[model samples]
Target: LKYIYLNAGKINYVSNLFFFQKDILLILKKYLEKQDTYKCFEILKTFEKKLDIAFEKEFKNIIYIYLVITFERIEKGYVILKKNNSEFLKNTLYYKVIQKDIFKNNGVYMYEALHLSEYFLSGYNSENFYEDRFLIDSFICKLLSVLKDIKIRNLINNREFLEEVIEYLRAAIYRVKNNFILNSEIKLDEIENKIFIEILQYKIKMNTYLNEPLRDEEFMMISRIIYKHLIKQKKEKIKLKEVIQIIQKNSKNCYSDLIAKELLELYPNLIENDIDFKKQLGLLDIVTEKNIKFTRCVDIKELIDLSFNDLYDNSFIEVEFTESIHKMLEDKKYDYLDSENMIIFYGKELKYKKELGVSIFFNESVMKIDNKKIKYLILLSNVDEYNYLGVSRDLQKIIESVKFKELEKLNSEKDVMRKFEEVIQGGESGF
Candidate 1:
């Protein structure tokens, strides 16, 4: 019987012992195969008045078809039963209607009716089965608990977001169980910014109740949800003139003036304060050497440690770059010019870090001049708009000026250190 049931879709075969029961069995089979669960519910309701032991031919046949399919699916490992309890089917409107109007609250008969409806209305797929409701509910509870800890529960307080999250998680569990692939349209890193990734890490830490790590697609989807609900709408509006003035004071060059002109020409909305300047700064700060600051000499490791400690104190999160100057030069992974001795990277300092809408830059240098190794670090803060203002070009010009004039004076490492100290002290004679 099981073999015949499993092969029903393939061979167009029916059991001879059930020949007289063909019509109802074929109707139930058609409904199950096509996943027309509502039709199955209608048919199940028609049999509510019949006793289980003395069911009418139509009711008996539908029950037989359902039993065979359920047993076959179980044998084939298509159904997984969790040991948790759930009252979703019993509490549903359909179940209530059947109990009140048809079963008349007869405990014995109501149980049978519910059993039949659970299989039929849920489409007989393990993914849609009532028992899995416990798992989904548990997952949602865990998710809510984690969100509450992060003070982000208010963002998802509406029904639409809740339903969407539940649907996404349910689909994720189904895909995981079936070994299916779920692709994300956006790259994980592109949408998963530092704060978003932090939230996800917290989620992962809190999701210990789950049996497995979540799929990357699930993480990406959840990140997108957080981004849409929280980050996108909560962007800080900063003063453009204040930021430009800071850049001018820090650099002490026409570099800020050049950037101001370019900004006015390129992004007039900034002057009018009509847009989120922080977002604009993020885009503008892509230049290689923007927000330049020269610092007194220190050992390489000490410099990195000091920079890391200072930034950490100031609400800056460090995103470690894989390719250091030594690694890059040793592996020849990237083309480096002979004169290109320094590397720098920067990112926005999130509100979670310190003052909201600020940016931080880290510059690391390793210089080898005349058998002496010179190491130093420069820290730039709140100047992400420098790149758009031609700071990198201005920096190169300054480097050229220093090389042409001060290189001859710097015969030893101590001379280089003295010159850098002079620059830090606002002396007239340093780059």
Candidate 2:
């Protein structure tokens, strides 16, 4: 004999399962209303098995919060449809099925709900390719811990830097894991470079998530960010006179006045000529020109290409060429009249039996001459004191002045020679 629910008491017993589910939902709703996020998470955990298959164990909390917040928004009639027209999300049958079945609230749009579901599924299933909030947050916590231990935490904007770093790390980690190549144009200063290496080394040692050594470009990107932060901190602290002094001391032959002038042009309020530096020693460490000639009148490519042998071979004053310059010419590193435009050597050269110092600068670029693209190499040679830093600084200034039209106009070998002589004579007058 079968027992039938013929009375109200029987109906209560038969519907006990529905009431239990309803009780759980009521508890979840109360947690949400109270804004007790942790309790809401605990309640979600209890009904984890009933959630969509796309919500993985690791991302269950995140998906649950997303769903609860989205449901709350729907109830408030404030559904926001983010613009994501990803073909992959649109083409997936799982996305379509979920859109049709789970997110059937009257207020939520079909595609918008599908997009959120697809995002959760992609993040969960493609763990190797993408990083979710949990992974990123955990990585950030560990990173901050290491930074704190290193004692350089105060040097950066902790919150801002970490947020940016987390995003970069997420992308970087995925690329590194998959052995992908990334290209970057960023370069770091010496101090920042050292810091980058130290930070990367520490991260590699401490973080198990980063399983392999990062590419140079990846390191460059990180270093660039750190360098920018360092620069921002140092900008106000760096005095113009101090920077000039640093350059003067390092360059050895550069005049402080010239350094001051160049620096003022680059940064107007950094230095004044009459300022006294009796007590303070500058802390900026930078690379500066020490043993080169600077000139503006002559093209570098034209100067290198000039047949030194043809011009000076018959002259009364014989020029003794150094073996280093000879090797450089043979290697075709410098721009020559009949050779490819290449720059291999640039520095002070010993000329005239090593008695007078000659500074040579060779830098190459492509330019349009008569509407045709031509490889232009610039050469600046000056006779100065051996390893004179002033010569290089002067040459750099001159090169900076050379315009495409000016370079294109002087095509004759005689004109090039005259321009070279003019630059050398002009540079020597200042010294």
* Every model: Cα RMSD to truth: 27.2, 27.1
TM-score of predicted structure 1? 0.26
Instruction: Compute each candidate's TM-score over C-alphas.
Output: 0.26, 0.27
lDDT of 1 by residue, 318-412 (tens): 33321232332233222112233432322222222332121212223455433434442333332322222122222333343364134324445
| Local accuracy of candidate 2 as per-residue lDDT tens digits, 1-431 | 01112121111112333333567655655665555345435433433334533333435545556666765666678866654544646566555545655554533576665657555554544433321222333344445455555566653333335546766866776666545456435667787777677777666643543335556677668767765654554454447666766777788578676556555555543343334532211101111122222223244334443423322333411354434345444433332221232232232243433222232333234533323343443332323222222333333324434533354456544454455445545632322
User: Model 1 clash pairs?
Assistant: 259-389, 315-353
Each candidate: what lDDT? 0.43, 0.44
Q: Which segments of candidate 1 are over 4 A away from where they belong?
A: 1-129, 188-191, 203-206, 211-213, 231-431
Which candidate achieves the best TM-score against the true structure?
2
Candidate 2 local Cα displacement, residue 44, angstroms? 8.0
Clashes of 1: 2
- Name the regions of candidate 2 deviating beyond 4 angstroms: 1-31, 34-58, 105-108, 129-167, 171-431
Candidate no. 2 TM-score:
0.27
